[model samples]
Target: MEIKESTLDRVKRLKEKYALIGQDIDSYLDGLIYANPLTYWDYIEVDSLLSLQKPKTDFPDEKIFIVYHQITELYFSLISHELEQICKNGKNISDAGQDLGWKDNLDVNFFIERLKRVNKYFEALTRSFDIMRFGMEKEQFTKFRMSLLSASGFQTASYRYIEIASTDLKNLVHESKREELWNADYHEQLDNIYWRRGAVVADTGEKTLTLRDFENKYLADFHRFADEYQPINIWKKYQELSAEDQKNPLLIQRLRELDINVNVNWPLVHYRTAVHYMGGAAGDEKGTGGTNWKKYLPPRFQRRIFYPELWSETEIEEWGKSWVEEVLAESLKTEEKLKDEL
Candidate 1:
């Protein structure tokens, strides 16, 4: 009799709770009669994700290329998640017009942990390029690449968003172009962003299809994000830290690691892949995107330094040049050796 009464009381509480949400307990139970238990595959949408790797070509190796890029984009999404959280935390401490107040002294360790997570994600991405470098046969890649005209990875909006969220908008503009746009507004400076400048037609100096399409899809969204993040980006958030915290070696080390991981290391590995497949004795094969990839892909040429304030003047001046030249020279030698063996 006591057990029956306890069960009844529990049901009565559940019914009352459901009533608050305009739901009938009996109706919900009736619906549940036909419901299935969730499975791992269903929860993670494994089928849907597997279906997304539809290759443009029938070549077996093309699937590897497509899937690797998809994996990289997923990693980018993960980094963006951490960055968004950091931005939100920063905003909480110093919302639009409010002064820093006591809240601005919020813990610096939290930001350091989040930044370290971003570095780890980048490390994973940098290491995974090995799959791209060694997985696909050069001949098959060359053939299938033609099918992907004007569809370069340069069109990755998330990559651009990561850059915009990491630093002030002024820092992203090329040093040479920044002076000319020194007094220009944010929108104008954004127009001459370093990547946009790199995406121009070499001869005509006009925007390539890749850049134009990216701008059409994401320009307004990027503009809004830049405005929102200008005050709360990681660099600015670091500045908000206490004087001693600002000089924390661990914090500064993470910043420098992020700069190298994103700007120098990743780009160098990617450029190595390009050089292996499209360059060398194979001749000047154009990139699928139609940009001058030789010039555009290299870190030395792009010089996309994220944290300029952290590096010395000489380090900034010699950024990406020596290491890039060495890598390219090595890649060229490997290609030459392959030809000689054949």
Candidate 2:
């Protein structure tokens, strides 16, 4: 049989590639011959993924709860991946979860493209959050929620990482302490991060078990990523661009959208879901993890703006104002009736 020119070229390139390291292409070919064919199910690990929904209760909605949360974490990972790629400027990123040093490849177009992608992720999440809103039976969920104990969605590490990688550590600080820690160091800033207060005891002013476990698992990681990304976070990278490049309208719009998607829309959806299930809006139902979701999930309360500079003084001040009012108006009627009955 006559060999095609393309095949010959490929073999020649393969020989050169292997020869660079004093390796044999034939040995690699031999290994491939013995290797089993990759199946789609195996490659995607569908079985393992399907096995993950080990609900603590017999409720069918509990499975939906588990699967939806897993999907959210996957998206969070993708967001972090894009942020890391931007920070590192597409440098060698084969080492999973390892910091790729910045490459100074600040292309405004690249920034817009990645920001667009992150915005799309949040949009999909915001829309699909209805699954949590209306998919689960309230009766089934409230019952299964008891089975969950301290394992609340508040404990996820990926979302926290996204927040850290998105902006200055000062922005992540609780609003009340943000001024006090304005120029504080990483440790000080991390100590006052707003989300830490999300899962605190409402009365005793102590960490909940969920927050404690979360801190034990990821506090060091948070410290490391906060320090590593501080000088090159998305906002910092935006500032690193040329003055004219920073003026790109699409970049500004995408960033503002990102700020809303992450801070307002995302939390607003959770706020809706929590209100539906938790006897929320001036009630005493804490999250399964004892997270202060009433205060934490409401964007108006959290008021976490990633790109505060992109917004006007009034826009920043009124951040999440309309949504809070809209939801509060609706929530108050039902919750107030419930309060009166209680």
Which candidate gets the maximum TM-score versus the true structure? 2
lDDT of each: 0.80, 0.82
Estimate candidate 1's RMSD in Å. 9.9
| Candidate 1 lDDT tens digits, 273-320 | 888888859557765445667877888777778788987777778787
> Which prediction has the highest lDDT against the true structure?
2
Query: How do all models score by TM-score?
Result: 0.80, 0.88
Displacement of residue 249 (Cα, Å) in model 1 is: 1.0
**Candidate 1 Cα misplacement greater than 4 A, ranges:** 1-36, 90-106, 321-342
lDDT, candidate 2, at 59: 90
